[model samples]
Target: MSQFALLGKRRFAPFFWTQALGAFNDNAFRNALVMLVAFQMGLDDHTVSLYTNLAPALFIIPFFLFSATAGQLAEKYEKSRIIRYVKLFEIGAMVLAAYGFYTHHTSLLLIVLFMMGMHSATFGPIKYAILPQALQQGELVGGNGLIETGTQLAMLIGMIVGSALMEIAGLGPLLAGAITIAVALVGYLSSRGIPEAPATAPDLKFNWNPISETARVLKLTGQDRPVFNAVLGISWFWFFGTVLIAQLPNYTRINLGGDGSVNILVLTLFSIGTGIGSLLCERMSGRRVEVGLVPLGAFGLTAFGVDLFFARPDAALIHGLNWLAFLHSAGGWRIVLDLTLIGVFAGFYVVPLFAFIQSRAPREQLSRVIAGNNILNALLICCAAGFGLGLGMLGLGVPEIFLATAVLNALVALYIFTLVPEFVMRFITWVLVNTLYRVRIEGTQHIPEDGPVLLVCNHVSFMDPLLLMANLRRPVRFVMYYKIFNTPLLSFVFRTAKAIPIAGHKEDPQVLHQAYDAIDAALAGGEAVCIFPEGGLTADGEIAPFRPGVEKILARRPVPVVPMALRGVWGSVWSRRDSGLGRARLPRRFRARVELVVDAAFGSEQVTAASLEARVRELRGDRA
Candidate 1:
């Protein structure tokens, strides 16, 4: 379906607006509060900074205190009903905010900030979980992209409008109250239009206590490794983002030398870059949750962040320079571009990770897992605040902090990649596939999205595994021969990818046992393990006889077996059929259409070596 269909669908459009309006109103009221205290009442710089930082703390506190309860509500009750209640809460919060504005009661305004947080906290699980229920699998990326872009844009606009309105003589409170109430009313109307999302766990008992429910949700997420890892990745993105964005205000004042205009510029550049990247996800991903983009994004983030630090103005701070003059100054324009690109890459980094978690998570427990993720995010944001404060106390300047954050991002990316090599491996494969051949995957639905599964494919070329890895959304552990697994330069790649190397029984019994044990463990952990059932590469570009080793593995593990066929790999330079004398002798610039066809999955009881081979052979047809 087209991406626009999401807006036309009753299920997604209402929730999208409700979320966008909520984000707009949140930022609007917060910005209005900041402007009221800072400019209208002429608060000290220290007080302004404290209030700015405290706002995040107040907002995030609800996620920690109430996210688990919110997840349970989303799972145990119809989502539409819950949304109506949340919208009503938003309206009530706006009423409190209106009162706070009329009385000029800063404390009441702070309390209203917490109330807004509570409203958002309750909406958090439903926001993510409802997408998978309402939209088709193909529309998930687009739907998420729209929501992300809309929210970011709303934040930018809300900050601008709120600040502008507060500066007016008599329009401040009226504008704040009018906008907040109108948006809340519109959100409530949208909530009424949201289609019914049935409860995934209707019988689940409600837990009013936060601590125990938080622990329960976390434990449930631990049961799914991929989903859990994706959650970690998402939370890390927030950590990185909080740190980066927090530095922008100071970076503009001290480094860019453009007063308030610089703040707007930074926000505009970063938000626009992120929105562009978010929208591009639908196109770049080809309508699937392509995680390879995540690594690509990480690379760009580090590259741009480091460049931004170096690109900062060399001169000491100057006063009264507008954004245009600032840009015309030495090294100023480059810094702005670098920051914008960092945000762009960050968008690339985060959007796909969210989509991956949503798509891979269990339908019944998705909301609970999202709640766990919210708790983690809140914890990380707090950590980020503490880290930033510590750095400032230690006499680190804003520029140095930016540089340190960039370097720290590189280190964190390295650590995460080291822990899960599948990210790096998939990145390499994505690069190769996109650069070399245009790959078209058919029958992707035939592959199970969950549970243990064995994929049997024809062994065609050295790039076979890379091809399959790039196409499949899930991480797959491949079983390769010892020789190929230990190849000089490729050995590091294989090892990093966590591929299992097996030797023939006659060659090494110990290695064979280890390989089988690894496969069993991977399956028990609910991972996809792929094996070339033919055992060895084709000697003459033809399907080889099936080996009984696959049958042995199945006998032990008893997982579903999926037959996959590869086309157009036989003629590739990496193919076993290639008899080139040297690297220069290999075929150059050969254009071939590569296809990875996924056939229906078969149970272990129905899949013998012979039957599996026949199924693969049929799919392979006359092509190798």
Candidate 2:
């Protein structure tokens, strides 16, 4: 479906505009206030720095203080109603901002900034949690992509428009105030059109006390390890972004030797790149929540960050050279390209992660989880500011700080990837599947969204597990033959992924027991564990006789058994039935189109070897 279809759907369109307009107004007013206090007032450097630092603090502090309560409110009342009220609050806030600007009251201006932040804080949970309610499971990636792209673009335009308006001789404050109120009113109108979204947790208890509610929210989020970890990953991205973008103004002036034009150039390049990458999420993800892009993003962030540092011009800043002149200078274009690509990679990395969290989080508590995310984002942004200040204090120039941040990003990314090898592993699998074939996954809804799941698929090739892992949003532990599990090079990936290596009883009784124990433990912990029932690759390119190992595992765990089949793999180079004699030959580029078909789950009594084999054959259809 086209991306705009999401807007026409009663579920998504209203919320999208409401959120987009909110973002636009937030940046517009904030930047306008910053310009008034910093440049127009002709404040000293120390005072300007103080207001600059306090602006973000005032904005973010509300998230930490009120997100818990906001989350509860979202879960208790209908989202449309709450959004309308928030827009009203925005109108009042903008009126106060206009007053502050007219009277030249810095204190009132800062208060309005705080109120703007508070408005955003209240809207935070609603912004993210509303998507899952509005979008079908298949549309989450596309929906998230559109939102991300729109948001970044809004931020870019808002800053530019706000700054431009603030510079107008007599019309600056009046225009900004008028624009802010208009946007707020439009957001309200858009929100009124939103269909009623019933509360997910109607009976959720209200906690008025921020301290206790914040603690409770954090504890609730901790219940889902993957969800909690995903939140951290998102928070970390904000940290990285805050540090990089905050230094751009100085970097442009000192290194690029461009005046105000460089600031616009940097913002334009970064925002455009991010918008492009965000839009690509739907296509790259195959309409699913493909987090493989996270690792890909990390790689690009580090690569371009390093290249940007090295790409800096050696000469000092020139007084009169414009942005065009700077670009025409030696090595200028490379710096621009590097910064733009870095932003592109960042977009690729973030969109999928957001979709993953939204799709996988429990429906009832999605708002609270997003609230937790907001808290962490606030904390990380604060830390980024401190880190940047410390670096400057330590005599690190802006360019040097950029270099340090890039190196640190690499280290942090490595640590996160090591902790969750699934990120890297999935990237590899996604690349192979996407490059070698067009993977069309069907019946994915049959797989349980939560709880212990045992997937049984025909092992057609060595890459079967990777293919399945890439397609499934939930992580799974694979049980593999000991020999294949221990293969050189691949073993590292398997081991890092913590896959279970099993051996036949006749070959190694100890290894067999260990494998079963691991599988049982994983299932007990509510993880998906996949096994090849045949216990070996298909020998003749046809469905092999059913093996009893799957039955035995189900007998012990009694979890829901999901039967899946991979078609079109038999013709791939890794297939056991490859026509080429001893060694298999590679297939033509993009010649293979693979499909993973998931069938309904079966109970223990309903899933013997015979019954399960019939189910698999039916799913495989004539291809089997």
Top model by TM-score, which number? 2
TM agreement with the true structure for every prediction: 0.88, 0.91
Candidate 1 per-residue lDDT, tens place, 402-520, comes to 77877888888887777666667667766777776677788878777677899999998877777787777666888999899988866766786688999989999999999999999
lDDT against true structure, model 2: 0.85
Off by over 4 Å in 2: 2-4, 42-50, 313-317, 451-454, 492-505, 508-529, 548-562, 578-580, 584-591, 600-608, 621-624
368 Cα displacement, candidate 2 (Å): 2.4
lDDT of 1 at 162: 81
List, residue by residue over 1-624, the lDDT tens digit for candidate 2: 877688788788888888889899999999998888888887899999899878888888899999999999999999889989999999899888888887778899899888988899999999889888888777888898889878988888899888989999888988888998889889889989888888999999798999999999989887887677778788888998999999888888777877887788888898888888888888887777887899899889889988888888343556556788888988888988988898889888888888878887888999998998898899999999999989999988887787888888888888877776767776777887777777888888888877998988888888787788778866689999999988887776688667899999999999999999999999999999999888788878788888888888888989999999998887676776654456645753234788899988887777888778888888898774
Angstrom error of the Cα, residue 529, model 1: value is 4.3
